[model samples]
Target: MTDPAIPLGEIVLPCLNEARALPWVLSRIPDGWRAVVVDNGSTDGSAGIARDLGARVVHEPRRGFGAACHAGLLAAEAEIVAFCDCDASLDPGAAERIAAPVRQGSADLVLARRRPTGRGAWPLHARAGNLALARMVRRRTGLGLRDLGPLRAARRRALLELGLTDRRSGYPLQMVVRAADAGWRVEETEVPYRPRTGRSKVTGTWRGTWQTVHDMRKVLR
Candidate 1:
């Protein structure tokens, strides 16, 4: 039930080799909201899947989460933008919950704090690292946010005004930090994190974790 007129918000799914999960992700978008998938150099036919399911597909061959997300943002024209991981880990059913605060004009930025429902949904070291980073973010920015979860929502214009430059794993952190610095009201909503359809891009291996940490350091510094 997509809106016939300009939509109030749009959900952006940053995808990479997620052909198997694209349908579920797009189906999770609530009625009346528009959906866009940023295909990140997927050789698995993810872009075609998105198109077949009635979602607008934007090609982003940069091969990074932030790069794909930034491309989606540029292509999105709604007043609000919500980002969801294309992998099945994060529930698409919670899109409305995550974007509610922003749509209601009560929050400038909202993060879907993950409540993992499966054992392997999150790795031990990754959880510890994320917690530590969350604390560091609290101390550094005074935003009081609890999670840097992949699922989040923001007012489109306000987000664009932040001038975020990170094109990797650090994009989320950069957005939150810069938004907080600019005095935007930031909030968190708990969303279930299930077992993902495929391996995580950032927490799947030692190399991935190190690269994420390195990129995050560049933003945090």
Candidate 2:
């Protein structure tokens, strides 16, 4: 049974110690859309802040990006499920535009192509890694995707049907690979990428970026 209170679409925010960014992130969610904040064992009071700001907080004890993302997906009841980082690196409001294609039955998956709005918004190492992955994706799937970005939207039922198994950094790549295999229509739109409020947990350091690339490469293989 669908809850009438539940909106037609919801955005899943995977949070890890993002208390400082919650207020801005939650406030920017499109009107009439629900925000599901999945707390991935944050030592900070991220969960409380999200709840206080009227976001539906789901606790994901597992400490991985995919784990938190999947937890939020499971907690969401909306027809459209969108994902955005809780770090405030990307605008949640852009979700409305990216999700429109899915809602209108024009695309099965929609990803945001991040165009950094500031000089330091995107780290050089992270960008290089992302570019390499995107090229690999194009070669493997022929999707013509420019970025394996965090801001994305898809139908909840269809996304679950993809049977995503990755519970780590490889999760997003796995989603695209599986979607390509399933012959799903994937689309991309440009969005402003801003500097995050707090230090990034992943892709903020050289080692972190390497680990992320390694995790994703395993999926590619």
Candidate 3:
């Protein structure tokens, strides 16, 4: 067990106009864990909210999901690094379970398989798109990952060595694909998924889901 006073790891949260959800998300971070909130040009004071809440805020001027994630990755200082959405759909507190395997040398990369906690928590189109993409990932990597969820953990140095290059929606999938190629012991566990606090920037509408699928397809190719 890690001492509550000692730092554990850093969790990167990519943000964009998520002020309302910031408080709830930040409060859930476990003791000794650092929160690096990557503000992706949020006009809703998300950056300030994060900073005031004791989360280190990294400003990524670029407006892509991958860009923001990469920025947070570069900013991370701990040996173990995790990533979660700032939308509050996923619990930041649950990162401990996801990260434990990596810290214990049991897994190289740990992903969260989301189990929706309520109706409308996950949109139908988004769910369908994710299923299709997961199938593609299985065929490409020979890995049986169920969900390409944002909540995940890995070693910071190894992740950097993957030399991830995607700066769009394909970033997450590219990480998994590259990890599999490198023979990393990628695994996953279930986490409850709740409805987000505000409008989703992606995977909330049919068009958004299609765009995400398209971006991920580029990685599969």
Candidate 4:
């Protein structure tokens, strides 16, 4: 049975050493909503902070973005599930935007576009690579997606039925690609993006970007 304290929809936060940012992220969840934070083997005590701040913490021993995200989905008992990163780059309240379309029956999936609020919000190399990759995805898959953002929402049943298998940085990419090919109604909304509290695990460095791109390319094939 779903917990009564958890409202109609739930938000999942995949965390990897994001202790400093949990307080800010957890504080912004809309009233009556629930947050599930999946700790992806963080030695930094991120799970403790998330628990203290009222989020249900699910420890995922595996240390990959997709693994944590999948664990969060498994823990979620709500009918609607939204995924968000706990890097403090995204506004936690933006859960409303992601959930609204699905709740209103207008769309099956929604992706949040990261509109950086200031300089340094996104890296130059990441930006260039993201543009090229987004174009490639649109041309090949025809999803009309602009960003492979962490802040996204969908009916839990629909998401799980896609049979997603990627468990790394390619996880989100696989979700987007599969959903598009499955004929899901996907949409995008703009959300304020700020600088993250700590160094990015992906999209902030050359090595991380390379791995992400490589993994995503593999998923596309």
TM-score, one value per model: 0.94, 0.98, 0.97, 0.95
Per-residue lDDT tens digits for candidate 4, residues 1-221, read 76686588789999989999999999999876799999988889998888988889998998889999999898888888999889899987988767899999999999898888989888888877777678878987887767787799998888899998888888988899989889889899889889889999888887778767887888878
lDDT, candidates in the order shown:
0.84, 0.93, 0.93, 0.87
* 1 or 3, greater by lDDT: 3
RMSD (CA, Å), each prediction: 2.1, 1.2, 2.0, 1.6
lDDT of 1: 0.84
* Model 2, span 1-221: residue lDDT tens: 87889897899999999989999999999988999999999889999999999999999998899999999888999899999999889999988899999999999999999999998899999999899999999999999999997999999999999999899999999999999999999998899999989898899998999899999999888
What is the model-wide C-alpha lDDT for candidate 3?
0.93
Q: Is candidate 1 or candidate 2 better by lDDT?
A: 2
lDDT for residue 101 in candidate 2, whole number 0-100 = 96
Ranking by TM-score: 2, 3, 4, 1
Question: What does candidate 3's lDDT look like per residue over 1-221, in tens digits?
Answer: 64564358999999999999999999999877999999999999999999999999999999999999999999888888999999999999988888999989999999999999998999899999999999999999999988997899999999999999999999999999999999999998989999999999988899999999999999988
Q: Tens digit of lDDT per residue, candidate 1, span 71-104? A: 9999999888988888988876677777888888
Better of 1 and 4 by TM-score: 4
Clashes (backbone N, CA, C under 3 Å), per candidate, total 0, 0, 0, 0
Those runs of model 2 whose alpha carbons end farther than 4 Å from true positions after fitting are 1-3
Worst 10 residues of 3 by lDDT: 1-10
Residue pairs clashing, model 2: none
- Leading candidate by TM-score: 2
Give residue 48's lDDT in candidate 4 (0 to 100).
88
Model 4 is weakest, by summed lDDT over 10 consecutive residues, at 1-10
